[model samples]
Target chain A: MRGMPVFALGCALALLLAVSAFSDEPARAAGFAWETDYAVALQRAKDEGKPIFLEFR
Target chain B: MRITDLTVVDIGLFDFDADVTLYCFVLNADEQVYLRYGGRDDTSPDAYLNEKSLHAALEKGLDLHGKWKAGELKLPARPAAKKPADYPSVKSEVIDRKQCVHCHHTGSGKTKLAASKGTLDKLKDLWVYPDAANLGLELDADTGITVAKVKGVAKEAGFKAKDEIVKVTGNAVYTWGDLQQRLHEVPHDATSLKFTVRRKGAETELEVTLPEWWRATRIERRSFVHAAEPFPEFWGRELTEDERRKYGVKPGEFGAEVTKFWVKTNAQSAGVQVGDIIYEVDGTRSAPYTGHPALWVRLNRKTGDTIKVKVLRGDKNLEFSFKLRAKAW
Candidate 1:
């Protein structure tokens, strides 16, 4: 009915909000953090005196 | 120390086989590549992937990092930085369209531009990221370069299963990517390769002879430029093991039966009939190790090249020569 349409729209908006929350965040696991910006990662590597693990997909 | 995840980036200096779903580079802040970590054959995208191999590569990366810090490691000067924005083809294809510059765009755009300019070496261009199996060695995925199986040339050269590969021509290799990177440097006309392997805790050096078309790989999966390759105009079905043994087909020879020919092709006109067992082409007996012979024809032969195909039909050996034609796009 009329209420069902509004309910579906509410659900769609909720889903969009849910996706946006995690979309920009890079993945991290087991104390290893992933950075999306290569320049920033390179800067961090130089500061920390370490090598980079660059993965391309 | 950081795991940098790249998406929608210009893969100019880091160019690899774009067909690969995942690839890794262990490098320093100065962009000096310490090691590469991912590669695959035509079997599957993750065919050579192993967590243990990555761990091994990372450990070696740390060692290189230490050496670099101590000023003991000497790496070649970094290549000049080039971005997709600098390439005309990429600029027009991706940048002009407001699309994200994909890793594959670099390869596809450059190849398309090369083809248009009539400068693309079809054979050499198609054979990218040659598989290690071409050397007749199948390294165990879990243990880096530990040889799990050996056949053909490596077997003939005394390579055995469980032999742990330590170096390629004296350069230490710690992972499949490292080994493949060395194989990538092999010249097309090079006759042999030297391998230093640790077997039963003893280092042994062996030489593997390179065969004709050894650099050839399965190109059908390489979407960037395979369509530009001239097709062979004939479909061939690989002869089953039983059929090959029954026909007394020798090892290191292409054993396939021509199933059909495209209509009006020079192959059909040259008297290459269906059901003919094609064993050789242009004096070459087989494709690269584990590759189909029909693909060999496509990768090695070009349009206007006169090809001599040898076949077997009902206990009779026959030969046919045809002018290769450009495949219709």
Candidate 2:
């Protein structure tokens, strides 16, 4: 049976590459994409007087 | 890329943070993701905190499977003060499920940066553009419309900057702030007609007369839970869409914009309308629900529950049903 439709088309192309590799973290967090080395990154925020920290992921 | 455990918050700065904040938890059930720190051995005041072995590995849960470096981040051991009144606080982390689709903020969410102290700041997942940069606006996604930035501002308010205008006359013309307040009440007028324009994509209509501060009372002095998380990391608790389009306000139905209101702390006698486009929050119709980190994970919600909303009010589609405003837990 043609190897059962080529083994069901290789298991539907590995289930579409396992749903696109778990959506690379929700498609790089749906456009919030960040990766700053800014060449050594570290500007450490100061859009007018620093002292900011409220991180949660 | 090995020891699964991360939830480090040592924060304690004045300026060298340049904008410093980095918290990225994407735990996908597998194993290994370590990098929690906060030391100076401290006797209090600032040795930092949140490093009790990553709170015993977030109470034994976060595991993501592979690739987790999460290095170079500081500030821990401050402790002592305590009492920011936990808004979006109180977490053990395990949201079994939540679906908002877009406008169900009736539960009124946003705000989660535990660790009681003083000036805490965040600007994580940013993007909000009015003058430029939504990458250049193409978006439509079922009428969240950007239709090429409103047809490039309707070829220019109806036909190329036509001399930065000296002619868009009478009753000060229909919305876009009544043609920017009838061009600032005839900032030296150029014509005198009145067809009451509104042709972004061709659909003629007219009825202009805007004053009374365009229905004033658009307050600000925020912080009733301001959610909008997820990004590459720098310092988290989210806010980057270029930092919510640089302090948020990207509404458009005719432009000449500026309208934002995400208040709480007992919402001072209700009167909200800043680009009005919420669409069912308590009554449940909700529309274009994509931004705001998918609307701050539906704010833990409590209180009477019933926020049916749907405000666009320009092409007319007004509906509201308020009654569910809790979430400061």
Candidate 3:
């Protein structure tokens, strides 16, 4: 039972490191707060009563 | 903000000018487009787009949104939705697992399809993108959203410089994007255009007559022309009489001075250099008064046609043969 808590701690640390690696990438720094999924963005726009700024390139 | 490279079938609703490579749309969730942001004449992405213009378009879109919410502005009815896969080029590309058909290619693809259906017309300007300059309204170079000058028809119709165009053809317009949308909806044969402008805290209505060739687009910039006609991959301007004289060409003869060549195009591949004067195309002495050489090719030649061009490079006259290729974008 004591080893179980230690395993959980190890798993949490691994997850944290994995997330840190991802967060440090250049894409995260330079990327705008743009949603890539159109359906989700459209729903959010409707819910928030906002217009969609759609960039198609 | 929605950034996407995914092929959305609903692009038909926008009725884009086909050659648009980068396009930004400000619209409601219901697909009522408030305006658009990007347009290009040259192949370069930054040709008519800049950070300041995009920012101004966004600000104006938000302002228009406010009016829309307050019921003060009415937007046009949304078009029936059609999937992009329904487009022939897109469908073929998707089935072949090739790269998605670009937005600009849609116009030429449609033109080719029309040609296959025996309905090709040289005079028709397929996918005409509207420029406010047609109405004599010059937009600010930096912002591209504000009115910098109103001359000719717009000025004669009581429009003044600095008057922000608030509505066009009964639809609210906040930026050039919105203005373009409204203008696109205008019938090619429409005799007049109605617009409302905000000037000095008041909105005024004005109407202007449409020019005869108002529906005609700049052929050099149109991808549809490149797709369907035997066109050079370089851009050139019609030579003035003085330029013709300097080039040793007879007066009233047509010649186009090559100014720039798009990178990686057939012109560059064929060793067609800048500063070369195109004096003849396919044995025809290109008449200067007829129109631009590129436009002349678009009007006369069909796709797959081979064109023999004579260029005066310095004092030497050189000849080159170029084949028209289908739209590759």
lDDT, candidate 2, residue B142? 20
Taking chain B only, the TM-score of every model is: 0.69, 0.20, 0.73
lDDT, candidate 3, B215-238, per-residue tens: 555555666666565455567887
Looking at candidate 2 chain B, the ten consecutive residues that score lowest on lDDT are B11-20
Q: Tens-digit lDDT track for model 2 on B1-329?
A: 11111212111211011111222221221211222221111122111222232232232212211222233322133334321121233222211123211111211122334213322222211111011111122322221112324233233334221111111443312112112233333322222223333334443432233221221111111222343222101111223345335433253111111143334422212433545434234433322223321132243233454444444445666654445443432
Instruction: Tell me what TM-score chain A of model 3 achieves.
Output: 0.43
Clashes of 1: 0
What order do you get sorting by DockQ, best first?
3, 1, 2
lDDT digits (tens) for residues B175-291 of candidate 1: 787787788777767799999999999999999998776776756556665455566767788787888888777766787888876567777888989999888888888644443
Using lDDT as the measure, the top candidate is 1
In candidate 1, which residue ranges exceed 4 Å CA deviation? A1-33, B1-12, B85-88, B200-203, B227-329
Span of ten consecutive residues with least summed lDDT in model 1 chain B = B1-10
Ranking by TM-score: 3, 1, 2
TM-score of chain A of 1: 0.45
Model 3 misplacement above 4 A: A1-31, B41-48, B66-73, B142-145, B215-217, B230-254, B257-276, B280-291, B302-329
Model 1 misses residue B306 by how many Å?
14
Docking class of 2: incorrect
